[model samples]
Target: MTAMHHLTTPDGIRLAYADTGGTGRPLLALHGAFGRGRPFLSLADRLGPDWRIVAPDQRGHGRSDRAADYGREAFLADTATLVERLDLAPCVLVGHSLGGLNAFQLAARRPDLVRAFVVVDMAAELPPHDSDWLDGLPETYGSLDALRTEIEARVSLGEPLHFLEGAVETDQGWRLRWHPDDMREVKRQVFGEHWADWYASDQPALVLRGGASPIVPDDIARRMLDRPNTRLATIDDGTHDFYLTHRTRFHDAVAEFLTTL
Candidate 1:
């Protein structure tokens, strides 16, 4: 069965997600900072019938609760709670950007809950991409298309949105679902600490980077290769949003990685 719904977190916060029940290993897919899990529906479809996919809309995204103090730990804690609540056995966690960092943190803290990790288009350490003013962006828009056009036009020139997949329309507007306040806090937490220095996961981890993304430097990607059980790959014609911009190549990399596990 295919379903999209909401689940309450440890602290009673409601988080939204998409769940597809099937036969193989259980896979949890987390979206980027200002992202919703639905954007990954195409990926889940292409993965075939071998896997059950669970894609969660981060705490402040999609149809979930929009509360204050929504930061990295809140999202991570909520993910851990969902895993325990659903009892996703032999789970393989797949994540992108901010989601990648949460996956690493979860595996590091609760190693037994995770079998492996697919880190998509995110490095342990990423340089800033002029995302500072994103929080202050106005939520009010005259029209949905106008909002999307503005966002797409503005973000296309930036580092991450240059590679996003499809856009969705909402009652408020057609902009990305990410809550601005939460987004600001999420960025602060992600760049606040050096990832390599803080992350310690022994499970198999794959780091996929976008060949076209300027946010991740070659040196940083190279240094990430030094980690144990961690291999690296790059997707051409893709920026930070490789899964959406280059679906076939992205799925190939993930499918190949799953086979090894």
Candidate 2:
């Protein structure tokens, strides 16, 4: 089971997180856009009892406070604050998509705060993409079932339930906990050429990419592997959200990498 917790940032945003209590090395897990920290609970469980895993909902998402700023600097600052406030420095940092980019940048900015890093299905230079589905999503649905049906039609068949992780019921109707505009802004800020940050630190890092993901193509993955002290693992038949789509394989790959650290 995971315990709920909150940490206030320097900017006064009350960020929410899930903690898998244990007396072992701390692993800071970060979720991608439109996601909270809850999905990592299963991965934390698979990591066994020896690892204390903490996954935080980034700003503007989940139960966390919304912020006006959604830039790279702000995201990195939030992670840094969370690490310092919780005394989780020198811990392993694991992130997916947006979170993955944040992890690499944070590790570069404060090497002392991160002992190792795992970036899942994100690359330094992301290809241009479309988020029209997210931007065009209806704010409210008549019922949760209706929302799920819509999501199933528009999103992935693999994890329709995962898309509903951040939904909540209200007097008005059932809707996502986050504002679509915030997510759109965040997506805008996250996509770009970021090889410099990826190469900023020589700390041990693992780059996990979906074999079929266009986000991190073969050439870019090879370039990412060119850096010293970095390793690459491909999850065959996995998409950009391979961490969720292939949980067991992702967990095993991460577990093996942790042992190397």
Tens-digit lDDT track of model 1 for 105-212: 888878888899988877777655556556456665667556656676557433444223223465765555565667677777777445653257778888887889
Q: lDDT for each of the candidates?
A: 0.73, 0.87
Instruction: Report the CA-based lDDT of candidate 2 relative to the real structure.
Output: 0.87
**Cα lDDT for residue 66, model 1?**
76
lDDT by residue (109-222, candidate 2, tens digit) is: 889999999999899998657667775789899999999998888774235655688899999999988888897889899888999988899999999988877778888999
> Which candidate should be chosen as best, given lDDT against the real structure?
2
Residue 191 of model 2, lDDT score: 81
